[model samples]
Target: MKHNFGAGPCILPKEVFQEASQAVLDFNNTGLSILEISHRSKEFEEVVVETERLVRELLNVPQNYSVLFLQGGASQQFAMVPLNLLPEGGKAAYFDTGVWATKAAKEAKKIGQVEIVASSSDKNYNYIPKGFEIPADSAYFHYTSNNTIYGTEVFEKPTTSVPTVVDMSSDILSRVIDITDYDLIYAGAQKNMGPAGVTLVIIKDEILGRSGRSLPSILDYEPHIKAGSMYNTPPVYSIYVSMLNLRWLKAKGGISVIEQENIVKARTLYDEIERNPFFKGTAAVEDRSRMNVTFVMENSDLEAEFLALSKERNLIGIKGHRSVGGFRASIYNALSITSINALVDAMREFEEKHK
Candidate 1:
């Protein structure tokens, strides 16, 4: 069995990849590859339409909300979000969690005043910052739902009187969430969706039109939403594969079922880490992520041997971010229970041998 633990452009359901590969070669038996199909064609339109429908159906998004599949990863949305929502000189509340959150805040700074309502940097981002007040006059309150590089997560989102915009790049569909809780949610498709190249944006109707700035055709959200994510030539293959993934998720009883599975998977690995003598977890227990399980050995001496053994066992991408040195096993949506179990087993086996 092969287990992939890479962070982005990570593992997808083998079935989804297989079906997508077929489409790339011969879409709908139309004798055309998805890559070459015109975005205006009915074939591609169906793909976009189905993707939108599946997104709303899977997440129970309200009618007033619009979903757009666009180019530029979540990073671009970071800038677009502040530009679209912030009034002239208006401010926004930002929570600094990790790399992505910092990027979002940095972009927001360019548009208007930014208040660091909360931050976890003091603790090296091993814990979530809590108990910050959102400025009532702020245009929107933005936070990163999960910190991918640091293995930290804000499980219970902070409440704000203003509109809430979330960068859900790493943990968008990993669980069930009420769409009404946020005005805008942006997720890069690479992590839990399909591939890199596209970003998913869900925006509420009310919060738009505040920017007032003249946005380039590509930077504006309304244009893409109006064109049904086909405003310009889209990444058809990525969106098509994401549709298949959403379909796979719907078949498995939607987000509720997967949320439970994610909990079990995370707990199984975290429990082993907590119990093992040579292992120590990095993220605070209360703020640990359900998708990325990060930990470190008692000493760094055995790192080479551990990685080599894991690779030998067909496990991949267990290395942590360079900024935070340790082991990070990314248990994304496509990662199976059996795979997590194998990682746990390997940990135990390694501990027994090393101890």
Candidate 2:
């Protein structure tokens, strides 16, 4: 069996893949493939509705929020959030933890004035900044909940009086979050939720028309909300697969159960990284992420050899990103504790070989 740890467009449950594969040929016994069905069809419409319902149920989202399945990934949300929430000439506050957070702030800058409340650039984003003051008068405060590249996460929402928005692409469903605390939360579905092509946005309804600037219908939240996420042809197959994945999540006892498993999986790996003399974790202990665990060998020369051994052991996509060139084991919802064990076993084997 192969263990997959790719960051995005990453692994989904085996059952989800099996079901999605069948749908590609025949969805729900319909003659047409899921890909071929009209977005307006009753069957496809049911899929979209169930997908939204599952999101709300799993997250305990309130009725006042709109759950949208959008086209562009979280990158588009970087623009849309500001376009909808940040009015012309208004200022927004952002916290920069990594590349995605930096990009979010950069996009907001194009729309209006943006203040970077704090940043971890001094430490290469290995940690989350603290004690930063968010301007109470800012239109909104934005931050990325999890930094995939740096393997850091802000588990606690910062105290801010202004409206709060989070880019949760990598960690949206990995744990429990209070929906009432934030005015908006957006995530690219590729990581914990499902496949690529669909981005999830949960926005408090009152914030929809606050920007005041006229937006293209497609870019505007009102049209999509009014149309029930069918402003145009949606990503049908992606939403279908996402629905299946969400079903899997619900069947597995929801977020609270999966969260405990994730905690155990992350700790099991991080514990080995600490106990093993040959390797060391990269992120600060307090800021380490439960979804992506990053670490490196003490002696860099043996890096390539261990990578080869990992491949030999059927470990795939464990290589780290270019920015932080070590190893990033993306332990998303679909990756099992068994896979984490496989990785820990590999680490132990590498240590024995080195010793």
Candidate 3:
């Protein structure tokens, strides 16, 4: 069997793929593929509702928050957040740890002032920045929870009096997070949630309507909340698949249980990287991401050989991002511990052959 470790639109449970395939063939015994169903249909409406409900239940989100399935993915959220939350002449604080975080901060700058309170750019984002102060007057403190490309993650949320907004595209549902800690949390479904085309936004209802600027109807959160994420033809197939994945998550015990498995998977791979002399982890030890474990060979020349060896073993997507030339094994929530073990075994075998 092939082990997939791609970054986004990454691995999912085999059972989820099987169920999603069946739905694509025939959904709910309706004799209609999910791809053809209308978003307004009762069947599709139930999928959207259940998907949102599962999100709330899995995260233990308080009633004060509204869960929205939106279009345009998390990248759009970078802009919508500033348009809807950053008031006129207001400034927002951001932690720039990697590429995605920098992109988010840049988007916020277009709407208003953005203060990059901390950054790890000096070290090529091998670690998460710390000791940054969030401005009290800032509209919101934005941070990406996990830096996918750099393989670094902020284990603890930044403590700040200002509203906190997290772009959790890479780490959402991977572990347990206190939903009440932030004013907003948004993630692209392609990561731990589901396929591409759907973005999940969890916003505290009171935070809306505070932005003084006029937002386009599509960018505004109020209308989407009022319509229950059904405004302007939601990504029907994506939401359905998300619902199936959420069901799978619920069945495998909730986030808390899944988190333990993820911890084990990450440790197995990281331990291999640490003990194997042929490789060195890229990120700082403490800040290394549990979702994406990036590493480089001691001699860069060995990179291609190691990749070829891994491919021969049916291991794939271990290559890192292009900007950062190395290997990145993305062990998302759906990725099994067995797959990680296989990768670890492959690494050990390759090392033995070389050493």
Candidate 4:
């Protein structure tokens, strides 16, 4: 068995992949591949509708909000949020925690003024910035809930009177969050959902039209909402797979149960990092992410050897991001605790052999 810990386009449930595979060859017994089906067909329409419904149900999204299954990844949302929410000459506040957060702030700057209320860049993003105040006058306060590159997370929503926007690309559905707290939430479906190509956006209806600029039809939220996420040819395969995954999530006792499993998985790995003398966690203890656990060997010389050991044990994608050279174990919802234990066992074996 292979243990997958890669960050994006990460592991999904076996059953979901199996179901999706069959759909690719023959979707819903229609004899047409999901890849070749028309987006306007009733069959595909049901897929889109059911996907949206699952999102609303799982997230407990408020009645006032609208869910959209968009094409572009969360990167597009960096611009879309500012385009639709940030008015001309308006200012927005950002919490710069890592690479993705900084990129989001940079994109918003092109459209309007962006104030970085707080950031952890000074320490290579090993922790989430704390005690920062969101400017009341800003259009919206944007933040990334979980920083995949840095292995840091903001567990609690910031308390701000202004509208709140979050890039939850990595952490969505891993835990339960009050969806009504944010004016807008966007996530790339690659990590915890299903696969790449589909982006999920949930917006409070009242938040739209605040930006007075005339956006292109594709960029505008109103058009997508009106068209029911079929504004153009949607990512049919990705959406269908996501729907299957969401259904699996619902069947497994929803977010509450899964959140507990995630907690246990994180604790299991973090405990090993803390107890083992050869390894040390990189992120601040208080802000460590439940989804991605990052650590480094105490002796720099042992890093390469430990990585080789991990590979020898069928532990793949344990290597960290290129920007930050260390091991990152991304234990998303579908990543079984047994895989985490296998990683832990590998680490112990390496330590005993070396010591």
Candidate 5:
């Protein structure tokens, strides 16, 4: 079996895939494919409810918070957040760490003023900036918790009193986080939660309608919350599969258990990268992500050959993003430690050949 390490549309538990695939033919004995069923039907509604409950329970989300499964991914959220939070002419503070963070600030600028507190772009986003200042008068502060392309992550929520929003698209649910730490959190479901079509949003209820700008019903979070994520036809299949994956995660002892595994997986791979003479990591040691591990070779010319060998060994998606131009191994919740080992072994093989 090939090890999958692609950035998004992530790997899911085998059991989740089996159950999701079965639902495509027949969902929970409804005699109807999940795709064919009316989203308003009780069966699908139960799926949404359970999915939300699982999310709340796993994250220990506060009762005052609203959990929603919506469409258009975190990219959509980039606009929705500023539209719903930043009032007319108000400024928002944003911390820029990578591409998504920059894009988020850019979108917010189109809606209102944005103050970039700090940026790591000077070093091609290889590290997280420190000692940044968020304006106390700003409407809210926003940041991307994880940078997938650069393989850097912000583990601790930056110290700020203002309302905080985080785009945790790539690293949500992989580790344990206190739900009350932020005013709003949005993650694209494709990375660790489920699939591409749905985006999971957890928002503090009081933050709604703060913008005072009349928004399109679909673009507004209030309407979606009022409709119970059924404002329009939701991403039925994506939500259902996410529910299944959540169930699998729960059965595997939830986020805490998976987090330990993730730590070990990341350490194993990083250990190989450090031990191998030919390899070197790109991200700062302190900010290196536990989800996506980015590394490069001492001799950049050997990248193509190493990628070819990785494929021969049944490894997939180890190639890094064009911007980074190195190998990025994305180790999501469902990716087994075994897969990490396979990649490490391949690195050793390359070292043997070169040494």
Candidate 6:
């Protein structure tokens, strides 16, 4: 069996892919392919409506919260977020956790003032700086929910009185969360939901008009909200696949149940990493990510050998990210505990061989 550990566009439920394959050939009894189905057609509209509905139910989002499925990835929302949220000359606060957090801060900086309230970069982003003060007069406090590269997660979100926006591109639906607590949250569908080409945005309707910024039709959330995500030709196929994945999640007992499994899976792998003699974890003990576990060999030669060994064993994407040279085992929600166990067992077997 193949063990997948890729960071983004990570593993997904087997049933989801199997059902999605059927849809691609014959969608909703339309006889036409899912890809060729007109975006504005009834079959497609039904998919859009159900997908948005599933998102609301999964997130427990209130009526005050509006969901939009739009083109471009989470990177696009990095810029659109500040443009649509930050008032003129208003200062937005950001916590520098990893590459994505820095990218969001940089995009916001071009349109409004941004303050790096706190950063763990000095420690190579191995931990989240706790108890750092967020400015009282700031427009909003923003943070990346999970650091994919460094394998750190906030685990618990930071509290702020101001409007809070989270980049949940890698962590959304991994567990149950209080959706009402934040003013805005966005995630790219590729990792957890479906494929690329769609980005999911959930915003509090009350907080949007406060920015007083005129946004382009595509960038503005209002247009998409007003039309129920039908303003333009939507990513119908991607949305359909996302809908299937959401249904799979719901059928398997929703976020609460899946969260328990996620904790177990992460614990199983982390325990192995800590106990194993040859490999060592990279992140701080408290800030380890449930989504990505990054580690390296204590001996440089063993690191190369580990990569080759993993490849020979059919375990792929277990190599470290380029910026930080170490292997990252991305345990997204869809990655089964069995896959993680295989990796850990491989680590043990390799440790025995190396020693």
Off by more than 4 A, model 1: none
- How far residue 55's Cα lies from its native spot in candidate 5, in Å, is 0.2
| lDDT, candidate 5, 184-293, per-residue tens | 99999998999889999999999887899999989999999999999999999999999999999999999999999999999999998899999999999999999999
Candidate 1 residues 1-355, lDDT tens each? 7899888779998889898889888999999998898888998889899999999998999999999998889889988998888877888889899888999999989988899988888888999988888989888999999998889988897977889999998999999899999999999999998888889999998888888888888988889878888789898888999999999999989999989999999999999999988788999989999988888888888877788888988889999888788789999998999999888888888998987
List TM-scores for all candidates, in order: 0.98, 0.99, 0.99, 0.99, 0.99, 0.98
Local distance difference test, each candidate: 0.89, 0.94, 0.92, 0.93, 0.94, 0.89
Q: List the residue pairs that clash in candidate 4.
A: none
For model 1, state the Cα shift of residue 294 in Å. Answer: 0.8
- The regions of model 6 sitting more than 4 angstroms off are none
* Alpha-carbon RMSD, each predicted model: 0.9, 0.6, 0.8, 0.8, 0.7, 1.0
lDDT of 6 by residue, 231-316 (tens): 99888878988999999999988999999999999999999988998878999999999999999878867788788888887787
List the lowest-lDDT window of 10 residues for candidate 5: 128-137
State which candidate, 5 or 6, has the greater lDDT: 5
- Candidate 6's displacement at residue 171, Å, is 0.6
Candidate 6 pairs with clashing backbones: 320-326
Instruction: Name the weakest run of 10 consecutive residues (lDDT summed) in model 4.
Output: 318-327
The local lDDT score (0 to 100) that residue 322 gets in candidate 5 is: 94
Q: How do the residues 155-241 of candidate 4 rate in per-residue lDDT, one tens digit apiece?
A: 988889999999999999999999878899999999988899999999999999999999999999999999999889998889999
The clash number for model 3 is 0
